[model samples]
Target: MPSLKDLRKRINSVKKTRQITSAMRMVAAAKLRRSQSDIIAARPYAIKTNEVLVSLVTRTNPDMHPLLRVREPKRGVVVVIASDRGLCGSFNQNLFRKAETFIKQNRDRYEDIQMVLIGKRAGDYFKRKNVAKRAVYTIGTPSYELASEICDDLIKGYVNAEYDELTIIFNEFRSALTQVMHVDRVLPVEPMEAEDDMMNVEYLYEPSEDILLEALLPLSLKVFMYRALLESAASEHGARMTAMESASKNAGEVIGKLEIKYNRARQSAITTELMEVVGGAEALKG
Candidate 1:
């Protein structure tokens, strides 16, 4: 049993903590709203781009483009996206675990496996393990410039044949309370399924299909990378919001329990004092 004074102090401390968690919850909620909206707005554009890419790939020959060529992945790179901060429950841990599992499972197949970490948490984790090949540490919440910079590095690696294959690991935003980790192939663009009635459609290329593909392929890759970053930003906010809400609720419960304990302890102290006084008066009368 804790003393009444100690219990009171604990109650006060818990109240302060609850207030902080509640404030964080509200902030995360506000950020989540904006991030969710951005993700929603970007989805249609990403989907349409993929659809166009699918149509184009079906029409073009694999031999005509370098991107469409499928070769054995002797060397590969994995881009792991995680949050810079770690107050969001298991978001960073889950992503790191998934990335680690992926690396372990594929270690035997690739001669060289390199890591390109996008977030501070991921980079730090890999750096501690001495496993990351290269890391990009400065990505803001939702910046196009940051996305473009990462895309440029990844493109350079692929174009130079430094890696025959590239994969991206990220948390996909499903809902406010749900984020699913996914691994997406980022390079050596796979040929998409052909649509029916391909000859009926006419594509007028100004500088031939080869030139169009040369331009579109890199742009398409950048768009995909941007979409991934946006999704990750939204997911991070969602995770933080949910975690802070849970923390606030837990803090409230603890405060309630502490209040009950304080009241009981105070009552016990009062009862003991009353009994001591009555016994002393009786003894004097005797």
Candidate 2:
């Protein structure tokens, strides 16, 4: 039973909240657009890189390549890509759930597990587990430099036999309203399942095919990491946009309800004043 003053104040507070939520929705939309465009632009390069790597593998003995080498898992590392800030529904939560599944599934195989978190949310989610080796959290857009830095350490670890398996988990951007969680094996690059139609690719090389592979291996792995970062960034933007839009709609509904309540309270106050005046006049006449 709030008075008129309280009702008015509440209405004003809700209006302010609605304004903030609306603004957040707009900002998220803009960021989502930019992130989607970035993904589109990077698609060609990533595709081309994969095609080239596939062609090279077909021409050479993949067994000789270090990245193609596979062995029994003794230790494993998982790279997790999530958003630094959350206001984004269940994006981070879903990813963490998947990560937990991954860890549980691998626990029987790997003697030890390591975590490399790409965002703050991921780090926080696993902080209590004591598995995180490193975390890179950024406020700005995800960049190639960050991916490269992360992959560098991963590559070094694999080469040094620090870990026998490496994988990455991230949200894959599908559309404005859709995102699919992806778990990609980054080490011992999974063999191309089927032969490409253009398999017989011939490239004249000054160095031997093995030498070329040595150089391309690192580049290819870097591209894979970069692509994951890009996808995660785009997904984050999309989730944030969707979440903000929903919040804005909910706020609108709340404001509507508050408006109704305010009107009722104000009307009740006016009615009370009118009844008091009539009673006073009747009393004076008597």
Candidate 3:
């Protein structure tokens, strides 16, 4: 039980909290809308580019391109995309857990396993882990230049035999309330099964197939990376918006309960004071 003054203070504190949460929810919603639009626009181009790139890779000699060359699974690296900030409920945690499980399960498969973490949260979460970090990046906004830089680094590492395989782990934005975890094998480009009609149909290239592939493969990879970043950003915003909305609602409920308590306490105090005044007056008259 608290006095009227204490109750009033608590109600004020909760009201302030509710205001903050409400503001955060709105801000997240605005960001989410922008992120959603970006991802939606990028998806079609990314998918089609990947399809064309895969078709070309399968028909050509894998040894012709270093990126297409698959090597022994001795060493591997996982690129994890997460948010820099907290308050996105379970967004970072889920990714961290998935990455942990992946590393643990494949520990016996790969002789060496390292991490390429994007976002501050990932750096913080994996800092104490036994795994080694190849690179850490802050995820500010998804940009083509950033994607190209990261793709080039990974390509360089793979060509230099620093790592045998590359996998990217990220959250795919599905809806405001739902996100799908995606684990994509980004390097050592696997050949997709070609359709029967397409395999038989030979098309002429103005440039040599090798030249076309040389340009397309890296671009495809960069597009994929960019799309992943967008998806992650959108998912983070969605998660935060959902989380903040829930917090605001919970705060409102708590305020309601506290107000009831405050009212009861104030009423009790008033009733006691009134009773004392009446009793004193009656005694004076007597």
Candidate 4:
């Protein structure tokens, strides 16, 4: 049993912590809203681009574009997205778990396996291990510039035959309280095995199909990388907001329990003093 003073101090400390967590929850909510909107806005573009790519790939040969060539993976790489900062519950933990599982499950497929980590948490985790080949911790926010640069490097690696396959792993934003983890193959793009009548749908090209593919295929990959980053950003914010809210609620519960304990302890002290006074008076009277 804690003393009344100790209980009171605990209560106050918990209240202060509750305040901080509540504030963090609000900030995370704001950031989440902004990120969510951005991802939502990007969805239409992603859909249309996919439609175009599907049609184009059906009409053109896979050899027409460097990104479309599929090969057996000899050296495989995973691009993992986590967060710069924590307090987001198991967001990063779950992501890292998925990444680790991927590596373990696919270990037999590749002679060489490596990780390309984005954000501080991912870098920190992999740095202690022998698996990380490269890391960039400066991904403070999701941006087109960052996405473009990442895609460029990945494409360069693929073109140089540095890696036969690449995969990107990240969290996909579903709702404020929910997120889905995704493992997407970054290269070489999976060619359409079956072209439907949808692919039969054609249009006039300003330039030759080869020229269009040369430009569009890379653009398609960049867009994909950008979309994944956006999804990850939104998911991170949502997870943080949820975690903060839960922390605040837990703090409230602790404060409530502490207040009850404080009241009980104070009452016990007062009762003890009253008994002592009564006994002293009785003794004096006797």
Candidate 5:
């Protein structure tokens, strides 16, 4: 049992911590709302882009463009996206684990496996392991410019034949309390099964199929990257918000428990003092 003074001090400290957690919860909630909206707006654009790409690929020959060329992947790259900060429960850890598992499983197939980490947390983790080929850091918040930069590097790598295949690993936003880790191939674009269904549709290209494809392919890739970054950002915000809300609730519970302890300790002290006073008066009467 702690002394009344010690209990009071502990109660005060818990109250301070509870205040901080509650504030963080509110802040995270606000951010999550904005992020969720952005993600909702971007989803349709991404889906339409993919549908167009599928239609174009099905109608065109595979040899028409270099991006559509698929060959045995001798070398590969994995781009991992994670948050720079922690305290979001298992958001970063889940992505990292998925990336690591992929590398380990595919080690035998690829002669070289390179990593491009998007966030400080993922970069640091890969760097400590001495496994990353190139890592970009300090992408404060995921934005179009940052995604464009990453897309440029990935395009260069694919064009230069640095890697035959490129994959991206990140968390996809589902809801405030849910995020699903996903690993998707980003380069040497795979032909979709639905492509065949779109092949019969009549369409006209502005210049020609070849020229339009040349321009559209790269832009599509950039858009895809941007969409991924946005999704990941939204997911991160949601995870943080959910985690902080839970923390705030837990903190409230802890404060309640501490307050009860403090009251009990103070009561015990008062009872002890009263007993001493009563006994002393009786002895005086005797």
Candidate 6:
């Protein structure tokens, strides 16, 4: 058991911590709201882009566009999206574990493998690993410019035959409490088979299929990268908010317990003082 002074000090410390956690929770909540809206708005455009790409791929030859050309599994690149800051619970840990598992499992499939890490956390995690990092970027706000820059590099590497496969790993925003991890292939865009009814119908293209594919394939890939960033940003904010809320609750519990302990200690001290005074009075009277 601690003295009254010690317990009181501990309670005060916990109260201060509770205040900080509560503030962090509110900040995270605000950020999450903005990020959630961004991701929600981006989903529709990303989905429509993929739909259009599928339709275009079905109509055009796979070899017509560099993005559509499939090659043997020789070299590969894995793009892992995490976050720059910590205090987001297991948001980055889960992603790192998934990326590690993927690399371990696919070791024999490719002759060479490299990483493209989008976040300081990811870079720090993989720094001591044996894997090579092709590029490492610190992620901030999700923007088309950043996405385009990353997509261009990926496309360049793919077009140059430096890598045969490219895959992206990210957390998809579902709700404030839920996030779904995804591993999606971004390079060598797979062609989907057209339905029989759609196959029979002929549509005219303003430009040739080849020209249309060239314009759409890269744009589609950039859109995908941008959407992934948005999802990750929202997921990070959600995780942080949840973690801070839990921390605040735990701090409150600790403060409550400490206060109880302090009250008991103070009462004990008072009782001991009262007993001493009563004994002294009895002696004097006697």
Each prediction's TM-score versus the true structure: 0.93, 0.94, 0.93, 0.93, 0.91, 0.92
Q: Which ten residues in a row have the lowest lDDT in candidate 5?
A: 191-200
| TM-score of candidate 3 to 2 decimals | 0.93
Error of 4 at 32 (Å): 1.4
Question: How well does candidate 2 score on lDDT at residue 183?
Answer: 92
Candidate 1 residue lDDT tens string, 1-286: 8888899999999999989988988988898889878877877877777666666666677567766666689998999888887788888899999998998988998888889888888777878775747656646675666777877787777777778898999998898799999899867887767667544568686777667777778778878778788888888888988999899999999999999998999999999999999999999999
Check candidate 6 and list the clashing pairs. Answer: none
Between candidates 1 and 6, the TM-score winner: 1
RMSD of each candidate relative to the true structure: 1.9, 1.7, 1.9, 1.9, 2.1, 2.1
- In model 6, state the lDDT of residue 80: 99
lDDT string for model 5 (240-275, tens) is: 888887887887888889889888888888999999
lDDT of 3 by residue, 55-152 (tens): 77777776798887888899999999998899999999999999999999899999999899999999999999888999998877888788888888
Give the per-residue Cα lDDT of candidate 4 at 109. 92
Question: Which run of 10 residues does model 2 get worst, by summed lDDT?
Answer: 130-139
Kindly list the per-residue Cα lDDT of model 4 for residues 1-286, writing each as its tens digit. 8777778888888999999999999999999999978888888988888888777777788786778777778999899988899899999999999999999999999988878898889888887776847546457888888888887888888888888998999898899789999999868888775445554655899787788878877888888888888888889989999999999999999988888888888899999999999999999999
Error of 6 at 80 (Å): 0.7
**Backbone clash count for every predicted candidate, in the order shown:** 0, 0, 0, 0, 0, 0
**For model 4, how many clashes?**
0
Model 4 residue 275 lDDT score: 100
Model 2 per-residue lDDT tens digits across residues 1-286: 9877887788788788878877887887888888878878878888888777777777787788777899888899988898899988899999999998999999899999888887888877777875646445553568778777888888888888888999899999998689999998879788774365665646787587788778888888888888888888888878888888888888888889988998888888889999999999999999
lDDT of each: 0.82, 0.83, 0.89, 0.86, 0.81, 0.89
C-alpha lDDT of residue 265 in model 5: 83
